[model samples]
Target: MESLHRDDEKRTLRRFLRRQRQALSEHEQRLAAQRLCHQLKALPEIRRAKRISLYLPVNGEIDPTPLIEWLRKRRVEVYLPVLRPFSANVLWFVAYQRDTPMVRNRFNIWEPDMRFSAQRQNRLPAWALDTLIVPLVGYDANANRMGMGGGFYDRSLAFMHRPGPSPNLIGVAHACQQVASLPVEPWDVPLTAVVSDQGYVRRTR
Candidate 1:
């Protein structure tokens, strides 16, 4: 079996996903996104978490912007990840209320104001985050995730695997991002669950 890190496999998948991302008409993409939103709304895991961390979309990844908006309205304290300039580590934080201002950063990703974070940040040990909604290129029911090779999330999860304080780690992918299986490394963090437009699947291995 080809491993995910295999240069050929990653290249092949990169091209495939790029084409797939471009082929979707905006309407089709948004509808697919809406379906995913609906499916997620019905998940007990989401409902159970009071504090959550999510990412701003890049490429055509399922936009969690809508979910973030709704979460705040429901009084759910939500956090967004801020990747430090030139650093892989992120400052996961809250303060993205509907009224929060966003500015285009050098990375071209829009970010919320720093004022949203506390003057004295909680900076939970990675594992202590109640729920981490991770982004993925491909995932399978086995809880494996294929990322862009940045190793940010992987390292963060590794930090969580310490003696105590690891929270539920879930991968959020588009229905199209699912694959037959994915290759994982010893240091790779297995996801607790994966959710797509189709539904949620827990990896039991």
Candidate 2:
């Protein structure tokens, strides 16, 4: 069936891209992270954002931590996504700071400890963020993002499909992750922009 084929294609692409990024040496990854921060800081959306959401890198995902100090200096509140309890594929943004308690989630990723009273108070809805930097398995010139296929982000950001203010979704990855094109699914949310180590791609519909 057509649906099965699409799934197979996505799986293939995801494996290839993940391997590509993982193949980068430590030095290459560090350099890429630095360049990525520079490109992101230059974005008008980032400059104007008071609250932003970012992720910790895993599985060769581009590291965005280099931008944290810069954002902190600018007094921008930084948040990390915490999986919503008992919710199917939903995430809640929790404030992250140097001293914030962290715990390994089911995915074994470190996240703000929501059990802490202070951390709980820092939670915000996704739409409330001005900008969100997401990790990408692969992206194209058209800003179509191929996520890890968990559908967590797509489902969490489904509100974008409705008529309402939505956060500026930006995908970040290594330049090598760029593909000529990617299949877009109905449930997939298009990125506002895609930034790579090289620079920002000129998004075309």
Question: Which structure among the candidates has the greatest lDDT?
Answer: 2
After aligning candidate 2 to the native by TM-score, how far in Å is the CA of 48 from where it should be? 0.7
Candidate 1, residues 137-181: lDDT per residue as tens digits?
787778688887667787667765567667677787777777788
- TM-score list, all predictions: 0.84, 0.97
Q: Give the poorly placed runs of model 2, Cα more than 4 Å off.
A: none
- Give all candidate RMSDs, comma-separated: 3.0, 0.9
Model 1's C-alpha root-mean-square deviation from the true structure amounts to 3.0
The residue-by-residue lDDT of candidate 2 on 81-124, one tens digit each, is 99999998799999999999999999999999988999889999
Question: What is candidate 1's TM-score against the reference?
Answer: 0.84
CA error at residue 145 for candidate 1, angstroms:
0.8
